[model samples]
Target: MPGITSPPLPAPDLIDIHCHQLSGSDHRQILSRDVHELASHPIAALDRIEALLTNRRYLSLGMHPWFIKHQTIETAFLRLKSCTHHPKILAIGECGLDKCIDTPMSVQIEVFSRQVQLSEELGKPLIIHCVRAFAELLQLKKSLAPTQPWIMHGFTGKPALAAQLIQHDCYISFGKALLQTGSQATLALQAIPLEQLFLETDAAGVSIDTIYAAAAKIRGIDPINLRRQIHSNFINVFFND
Candidate 1:
């Protein structure tokens, strides 16, 4: 008689810290098998959020600073406040200061601060999108004294900036830029501790598997080890698993 066979275990899901593709679009086919993605939706996309929650997808919502330049802040804030407490909303941003944008810095600061307060009130983490305004963002994080984790998504900053953000207990997420040798993202990846690092695909067409491989190569470790460590970080930040 043949020996009894054992069933195979499920594959571990690769955690993508932030991705817009999974949220408001029909591009869901792009998601590879064995991926746990956090979809980020801006304030304008909130209209479809009820459907997202019905589907039980993990999400992050915020009023991005770019919208403040083109739209009314009052209406944006109203929409943002209404959907913040949704059970599927795991984080409160992709919102943060952006000095490079047309939106006045003061208005951006005002809007960003409110989102920070909302994240604090809800006890959810923040998915920060900062550009040329790290100092301001850092200052605000200090002043707010938030207890929840803040992940700076798509980080391509210098090692010093990465170190500073990590010092303040912020998690740094790297994306496609990790493929470029001698890039700031690569340097920062080398400097940051594994526990504080995350990998994201953001709006890029690249797969998270590609990102994991690049990161593991840069860190000189096996891809499985990197994936396991980041899986642990994802649980620590989002699920407390």
Candidate 2:
């Protein structure tokens, strides 16, 4: 398979905390690619990571619960662990619990726990993907007490959920859902503390700029100020600088 490719671009003040497909925008993005997608070709996975990093791109690698298989978990996780040390690999997930998936909750917990441990061991933050599993997810967070930040990406939950997660020190990221008027995401975006928030495109195929614009409008702020605030949150969470 072809490795991920992108041309060199100037460093962006605006940031996309998580995305699957690369966009043709100038802003910085942390691409979220599953390690399991290339499990059979470890070299290709490494090469893709290398190419992205070589071109000043960033990414987060993880084994998503939806793709978790008893047969492939070990091999895929080994592959994921091998690449965690790279500086450009900013976070350890897109991984978390999902009650909607057919995968057993026990198995999901085991895999997600492993990644959580890995993230802690490596001192990297997490980009989380959660669906209808907040209870279990919050339990894990309380028990683990991980020092690194856990960003709940692509959140479309109500303001209460966003507030709960923020109270626990987890950052919430909004995506294409923000563009939809009267969406839970839009309402939550308005209520979320600016410092504990982020923006993304996920696999939505929308431009990060569009997401930012929608988010700014919902929060009654200029796009440029929104960009600056999110960029600041990005640095504080990912780089701790």
Per TM-score, the best of the predicted structures is: 2
Candidate 2 lDDT by residue in tens digits, 1-241:
9998887543347788898877764678888878876657766767865675534468888888988863478888788887888778899988999988799999999999999999999999998999999999999999998999999999999999999999999999999998889999999988889999898888887888888878888899977777778888888988883
The sequence of per-residue lDDT tens digits that candidate 1 reaches over residues 139-188 is 99899899899999999999999999999999999999999989999989
Task: Please provide TM-scores, in order, for all candidate models, with all chains considered together.
Answer: 0.83, 0.91
lDDT of 2: 0.85
Candidate 1, position 26, lDDT: 21
Show model 1 residue runs off by greater than 4 Å. 1-11, 23-56
How much does each candidate deviate from the true structure in C-alpha RMSD? 6.0, 8.3
User: What TM-score does prediction 1 earn?
Assistant: 0.83
